[model samples]
Target: MYKLKTKETDNSVIEFIEQVEQPKKREDAYRLLDIFAETTGFEAAMWGPSIIGFGKYHYKYDSGHEGDAPLVGFSPRKAKISLYFATGDTEREHLLEKFGKHTTGKSCVYINKVADIDEEVLKELIKQSVLFLQERYPGK
Candidate 1:
């Protein structure tokens, strides 16, 4: 069985944000916290050591691999802030066109800081991610 390393924990999200070494990144993390929480209408929770996640859904793939994951989340890493959204969503790609200074990986959007991107777009991304997940993994 494969284990998921980013399982949600009962850790304090505020404490984790406070421990961020860079003052600017720490501040950006706080702002992201508010954005994700308000947009998702769900409280933030700690996922693993770094990720602050809001809302969750259970997912079981065709290969029988399954786990619960946040509907949306972010991590303020040393290099940049990683924004997590639903994978394979075309709407996400479209929204990113106007998201401003950011880079995308397979499942994350990396930004140097909060000011580098549009907050309204971020909120829309958050909303779409939650809706996508809820529809994909209905009742889970």
Candidate 2:
């Protein structure tokens, strides 16, 4: 059986942010912390060593893989900040069109800094991701 590695832990989100080598990235992490918390109405928690996540949802795939994940999250990384949001929402793609300087992966958005993107669009993305995940994984 495959086990999830990124389980939630009792780690300190603030302490994790403080360890970010880039002072600017550390500051942006704080800013993103506030925005995601306020927008999603979920408390930030540590996911693995790097990801600061909010809320919780349980997901079981067709292959019988199951685990819990955060509704939304972000990691202040060395190359760029990674924003984690639920996939499958077309609105997420639409909002990313106006999200400014950012790149996308399967479910992560990479940004150089917070100032490089529109904060309002970030908020919208957060809102949409939370809604999409909640609907997809109801009761979570």
How far out, in Å, is residue 136 in model 2? 0.6
Expressed as tens digits, the lDDT of each residue in 1-140 for candidate 1 is: 89989899999999999999999999999999999998889999999999999989999999999999999999999999999999988999999999999998989999999998999999999999999999999985
lDDT of each: 0.94, 0.95
Residue 63 C-alpha lDDT in model 1: 98
For model 2, residues 25-120, the per-residue Cα lDDT tens digits are: 999999999999999888999999999999999998999999999999999999999999989899999999999999999879999999999999
Which runs of model 1 end up more than 4 angstroms from their true locations?
none
Model 1: how far residue 85 lies from native, Å: 0.4
Worst 10 residues of 2 by lDDT: 131-140
TM-score of 2: 0.98
